[model samples]
Target: MSTTLTLSTFDAPARPLNIPLPIDPPEGGWTWPPTSVTLIAGENDAVLIDTLPTVEDAADLADWIEASGKRLTHIFITHGHIDHYLGTAPLKARFPDVKVVSTAATAGIIAEEQKTKRDTTTYSAIFADDLVEEVVIPEALPADGRFDLEGHDIIGVSAGQSDTSESSYAWVPELSAVVVGDIAYNDVHAALIETTTPETRKGWIATLEEIQGRNPQVVVASHRKADAVNDAGALAKTIEYVELGDKLLSTDPRPTLAEFVARMVEANPTRANVTTAIYSGAVQGLR
Candidate 1:
């Protein structure tokens, strides 16, 4: 018999960056929006989705999970972004036998991040003091993309592009929930750094639509505002943001990066991390 499941979240606070950016910093400095780790617990076992970005964060998350008194059976990474999987080593240290898996593509990307020293080089340029020193690339998930937790199924669906090229989300039918990594942002600026072009945005919109069609009762954004609600409505808001970004990029006599960011912020006045998300994307020189 399938055990009844409960879903919970550990929302990590925004990390202030050490690097300087072209735009004015917020309060202290530029900050990555807060990210979350979802826990799906059954009677005695649970599965974790997306490790946070740093060792200290993961250590705290480990303590939180330990308090739940459930055996962590697996750690499923939603994407290959350094922030998403960097905490794996600490979590693995805490739960030595927990399996860590991701899609082959994401695994390859994480492997590349390790091989290229992106953590110590590119990422280090900004979060030098906050990043985990060790790299932990997850093993590839089974081809079927299914994991069993107390007889319930958690499936991984491959997503073409979002904040990153190779991404995926976890689908848990038993709970009517979808752990959509960076595919959907809640009350935060959508990361446009990678998917600045119209075509890539279209693919992202399609993925969000697919998640919408599922009509999940619970939707978790990997990067979410602390106060934002976790519901399928986030999918529509994310699509709207992507569409607005596309329009802004295509404006005739295209707006200056400053102008572009101003229009986006005006449109999304309440969204957090305009500097990191909107500014960073525009700074990429998107046309």
Candidate 2:
């Protein structure tokens, strides 16, 4: 018999991690980490998809998990972005028995996440003294193996490269849900920093296409609109975001970063976290 599968979502409020720009002194602050994490509850155990960004954020999520009354069996990290899994250490301490796992490529990203955090001006400027000091490095998920839980198989979809390198999605068959990390964003500005070229951006869209091929009813993304958290149409919104980005980037006259930002902001007037993110993408020829 198929076990009854239940999924719950947790959203952390957005905060500032300042980033400097060439023209605009500072366009944004305190509106980014509307990060959404998932808890998949099964008959005897639970699985978590992605962690929050800061120690405080993780602690809050940890408390919620403990109160949920489900044993955290495996913490599934969707990708390697520090924001996506930085809270792994704190969660591990709270749930000592939980096995923290990720794709081999993600594990490699974890190894370098700290250094990346420390090196970034925007990240280090805000969290210089208090970054995730002790990152809980995860073991590689089984090769070509299904992450079995309560009769459900949590498989990883290789998203060639997204906002970061070696990104992926956690595809759970029983629930028809895909825990998309940074590969697909919902109602928020898609981070296009990684899509600096035509090829990579195409790859990102292809990854989104892969998600559609699975025909998931529940689409969960790491970053999402707080009001519409876990919206089933999130996947389409993400696809739209990227397509819009492409159009802005390859327009006739070649609009500058400033032009792209203004247009994107006007179009997505209410989307949170547009500052350095859009600037970066625009300058890098993404937006």
Q: All models: lDDT?
A: 0.84, 0.75
Tens digit of per-residue lDDT, candidate 1, span 1-287: 44589989998988767655555665556777788889999999999999976767888999999999999999999988888888898888999999999998999988988888855567767763567768888889888799889989999888878867788999999889999999999988888887767888888898899888898999999888877899988899999988988887766767777677777788888888865654555466842
Off by over 4 Å in 1: none
Please list the Cα RMSD from the true structure of every candidate, rounded to 1 decimal place: 1.7, 2.7
Q: Where is model 2 more than 4 Å wrong at Cα? A: 22-30, 114-122, 127-129, 229-232, 282-287
Instruction: Encode model 2's per-residue lDDT on 75-103: one tens digit a residue.
Output: 98888767777788888889999998888
The model with the greatest lDDT is: 1
- Give the Å error, residue 229, model 1: 1.2
Supply candidate 2's per-residue lDDT for 205.
80
Model 2 TM-score?
Answer: 0.89
TM-score for candidate 1: 0.95
